[model samples]
Target chain A: MNQNYSTVAQRSSSVLATNKVLRNTYLLLSLTLLFSGLTAGLSMFLNMPPMTYLISVISGMVIAMFVLPRFANSTAGIGIVFLITGLLGFGLGPMLTMYASLPNGGNIITLSLGGTGVIFMGLSAYALATRKDFSFLGGFLMVGFLLVLIAALANIFLQIPAMSLAISSVVILIMSGFILYDTSRIIHGGETNYVLATIGLYMTIFNIFISLLQILGIMGNDD
Target chain B: MDWMQIASALALGMFLIILFPAALQMMKNSPKAAPSDWKAVIVPMIIIVLFIMLLIKLV
Candidate 1:
């Protein structure tokens, strides 16, 4: 009886912990989205470019992300959020401008958001229900991602539309795998911290959303 | 389709990829009731913030 009770207690505690992490992550994610949208609007109002400078900024931001995890527990995390928000805001300037300038700008945003929503709902469900170990995908996805990056950089100078579209498609696929992998990690006891899980899941969602937007832009002329 | 959107997405995507693992590692290694010190989040955050500011200003 004592042993059974201990097991029950352990299970309940873990469930409670998972619930807490999921709740916090969702709250923070929403807050980040709100801030991102606001910054995007502000940048558009300030007449920021939709390209060039954003590329450089993003490059810098990527590099910073590498460095930030080393300081995850400090007040520095706040600074990291500020930086991410700023970059995200700047990044949105172009979309914001396009949306405001084009007749179908709102459509583009809506479609992108909707597409992201669908992917998240579908992939997350799969992750939760499926029994396959997605961690095996980490290596393959990394290789594919590297190739995509190289291809993307090469295209900047080569100026190939087809190549860009192809890269975007692959990115969408790769990021989806990441979502499955990350979520499964959490479910399988591979990831125990909600903060970290949130970051992983957030990245997966962010990429998936952006890639969907790219695909929509390439295939649909509604915007 | 536009260059800016591509660049922005790429930048955000890459940063999160790097941070996600680090955040996980931090959590995994941390002890209960004494979350490990996260001094590592500074460099990337500051770098990213500066970049974002610059992007906003220059773009």
Candidate 2:
């Protein structure tokens, strides 16, 4: 399959790269996921309002953009990652609560979670094994990413269900592209810091789950 | 428009504005993909689409 990756001399730098960062990224990612889930459960138990979701997510985004990068190389970065994840997960509680009120909501949530797991694992494995550079995805994903952001922002006021469904479907594909790009970056040394890398991968998984949940939930409602 | 909706639209707009330049720079600096490279990504993406469709049907 990946001939260059198979042989010793021709092996892509990815296979030869220090896999310690990769291993650590996964470890930290799992820990953050558990922390986030715990916080989400706590938020739901407290009956957090929908606004809390909006507020916390906005706060988390601000922190991620302005603060996390400065400290991403330090141990403090780990704390920041947990803080951001917990905040976002806390935000997620109300959304999940809303979904849970629907018929067959549990199935929708479970399947979205499971589907996220399968897609992340499958894409990550492929990226790792193939040893192909996905750097070219940079420009394409950027255009797609920006266009989708504009569409999503417009849809907020439009409140069109079909448009929302289309957005969610496109989001699934975009996040998948990100997974490949991010994973390949890690392998090829384009991404070295485990903290930053974990955050990238974590966000992709989170988005995939959210988009999947929305898509499946909408489909169920149509039944 | 409601205050909340206006606030949301502003927030999303600001997020895009903040991120755009850096995203564009990164895109410009990265290497271009070969025609052959597209082959690898398209195959899995198709499989993913089909798998998602199946999940929708099964559910």
Q: Rate the local accuracy (lDDT) of all candidates.
A: 0.60, 0.87
- lDDT: worst 10-residue window of model 1 chain A: A56-65
- Which candidate's DockQ is highest? 2
DockQ of predicted candidate 1: 0.06
In CAPRI terms, where does candidate 2 land?
Answer: medium
For candidate 2, write residues A153-220 as lDDT tens digits: 99988999999899988888988999999988888888889999988888888889999998889887
Q: Report the TM-score measured on chain A for model 2.
A: 0.92
The local lDDT score (0 to 100) that residue A87 gets in candidate 1 is 69
Per-residue error for A140 in candidate 2, Å, reads 1.2
Quote the lDDT for A85 in model 1: 51
TM-score of decoy 1? 0.69
Question: Positional deviation of A45 in candidate 2, in angstroms?
Answer: 0.7
What's the CA error at residue A4 for candidate 2, in Å? 19
